[model samples]
Target: MGKGAVAAVFALLVVLVLAVVVVLITQGSVAIPLGEVVRVLTGRGAESEITRTIVLDARLPKVVAGLLAGAALAVGGTQMQTLFRNPLADPFVLGVSSGAVLGAAVVILGTGGVGWLAGLGVVSRLGVTGAAVAGAAAVLLIALGIARRVGDPVVVLVVGVMLGYLAGAIVDMLVYYTDPDRLQALATFTRGSVRNVTWDELQIISIACAVVLGLSVYLAQPLNALLLGERYASSLGVNVRRVHFLSLASVAVLSGITTAYCGAIGFVGLAAPHLARGLLRTADHRLILPASALIGAAIVLVAEYIAGGNGLTRTSLPLNSVTAFVGAPVILWVLLSGRSRKQAR
Candidate 1:
């Protein structure tokens, strides 16, 4: 697509994201007015303290968390697709998220007592986040090693799926023997939700995501070269091994921090890049990266709204349930339309 078209698409995505943010902030149980939401967001204080508290405390963190998690996952997914030369590669699909969940679960469930992690404040959160990052990195390394030896995208994809299941199985066993009270903390890890993210946790998420996302900008040209093949990328002095290491590390941090806070959100990583590519009509990482981030953020916000942002329902649905509606169809289209096979070869 032309630069103008790309710019227009990005503009529209930004607008969509902003619109969703407003709607989510305003449509919750108490129904704050748009004017008030805007006022509070702009630092003009709301008419009522309760409205201010609800908007700033209750909703803003969720919105910010969604934006960060979506952007991070989308970028990680884009990188994974290019690195593996597989259309289906993503952190969640490749078991990275599940690994992170397992790591966090160990920390949360292995603690001395119920709510141990929660009671310790930011330090404990950091420990869990670090463990999550370690677990994601472990899975990433294993997957990359296998992918290199196997050298088949389809096989790599299958292996990734198996790894995910293995990690999840470990988590299930842990949950089985754990205290029921600690299980509540593990609940979100499986289902996914941004509702519990606090301003402090957002601090860690924002910093880690910011650093990794910035690094992705540097990796973009190298990634684009890898799309042609590792040999071609190496021919162009891309340092294929270094590029692979950096890309995998980036994916680990992005997926790990997101899963740590947001609870193994699926499909946004898998679906958003495809949507961005479909819209941009190109695989240029420079364009695809930012576009994917915007699209991913919008998708998560919309899903959150549908899942319970409206506050009409007493119980919110698991985010994975809402995201599957988008991801499953994309997976089918890729398989049936031969996109996955084409990319595999």
Candidate 2:
């Protein structure tokens, strides 16, 4: 894409994100008007106190959670694709998200579910996030270890899928053995939803996302170098080990924190970067990262809107249900287009 075209695409993505944020915040169960939404956001009085509370307290947090989770997942996916040199690689595909869920589940289940975790201080919340990061790190390390030993990206990809299944099976076992009453807390994490996040949790998520995401910018050049292969990247004075470590760290933090807060909302990571790559017509990380972030946020917001944010359904759908539609096709396209094979070579 030309410079002008890229700029236009970015502008459109930003506008779409903002529009969705506005619509989702205002048009929930109560259906506040756009003008009233603006007023409440701007500190001017809303038409009513209930509208203000609903927009500011209830809806705004959910939208922000979706925005942050989407961006984090997308950026992580972008890094994963580059690191693995596989088009289908992502937190979900690589079992990083599953790892995170397992970590949280251990903490949640071991401590006696959400109630016990709640009994602990804010440290417990941070602890959940920490466990999640640890889980993602474990999966990343295992997958990378396999990738190093086996040059075949296809084989590594299958390994990742199996790892994901193993982690999920463990989680299911935990759920099956655990108290039935405690299962209520696991529902959101299993299926994925942003409705349960609080301002406190958002504080942790936002800070973690912002810090890790900002650090990822420094990896762009090294990541771009890696796309040509590890030998080429090393030949260009990029320390392959350092680059891999940093990339995995970035991915771990991003994927782990999002999973901790929002559950394992799938596919945004796998799909958003691909969308950005097509939009920019280049694999440049500098452009792709920001574009993917915006695109990712817009996607989650739109998905949320479609999956009952409009208040059409009594029960809200899981985010994974919507994101899987976008992500699964990308996976098939990557495999069938021979991109996965090419990368493996």
Candidate 3:
């Protein structure tokens, strides 16, 4: 496809996603009309105050969180996939989510306060966010080390899975020994609710995701070069080590912040890149990274609508489950098709 055609299609996709989000904001159990939704958004409605509260104070932050988290995860996933040279690679493939969950759980359980991890003042939230970032960085460091030495993407992917499992085991052990009340709080972090995120917490996510995603755009060309092979990239004057560090740092921040707020929103990181690649018909990071971000944002917003946690359904589904529904199939396909194995070779 021509560049203009591809750009047009991507632009349309983003508009469609924004439209869907507006529709979703209006059509909850309360059933605000679309006209009112628009009016409230535009500051011209009879129920302006009520509608504004519902849309802005309540739903808007959640929607923003979903959008940023999804885009962050997708961009991180794309970087990881290219760095590892494996379609199955994703942000969580390095156990970042597991580490963040573990860190949050430790804070919640160790402090014996329900809100210790999530409800502390901004200072405490920042503390937890910092911990999550540190944990994710730890995992990323290990995963990158293994990826460099192993040179097999599938093996590295499996190693990351094992790291995640190990992190999970530790978290489970911590939970098993801790107070049950804290477990309840941990539940929200694990289940992945954009709803639990206050506007205050949203700021942290916004800064982190915005900075990381912006950096991803800056790194895109170098990443594309790196994708050709490390030696070739070095020959072309791309600093392989710097690229690796910056990329890993970006992934760490994106995954860590999102997990801290959204609670390990699985598979958007894993699935969105492939979808973007298929849609754009290219793996060149220049286009794929940003396209994945848009698609990821759309997917999360749509999933949030479907999860019905905003009083849209009698029973709400967890965001993790919703993402799993989309992600697990892609994972199975990669495994069964031997694509992962081929990438390893």
For model 3, the local distance difference test gives: 0.83
Candidate 3 Cα RMSD (Å): 2.6
Weakest 10 consecutive residues of candidate 3 by summed lDDT: 111-120
Query: What is the full ranking by lDDT, best candidate first?
Result: 1, 2, 3
- Tens-place lDDT per residue, model 1, 26-139, is 897898888988899899877999999998899999999999999999999999989888889989999999999989888989856325667678888887888899999999
Give one digit per residue, the lDDT tens place, for model 2 in 1-345. 788998999999999999888888877677787888889989988768888788878898999999999999999999999998888899998899999999888887764546666677667778788888999899999999999899788898999999999999999999888878767766777787888788888999989899988988999999999889888989999999988998899999998898888889888988999889987889999999999999889888888887785585787888888888888898777667686576789
Instruction: Write down the lDDT of every candidate, Cα atoms only.
Output: 0.90, 0.87, 0.83
TM per candidate comes to: 0.96, 0.95, 0.93
Clashing pairs in 2: none
Q: Which candidate's TM-score is highest?
A: 1
Distance from true location, Cα of 322 in model 1, Å = 0.4
lDDT of 1 at 122: 86
Please list the Cα RMSD from the true structure of every candidate, rounded to 1 decimal place: 2.1, 2.3, 2.6
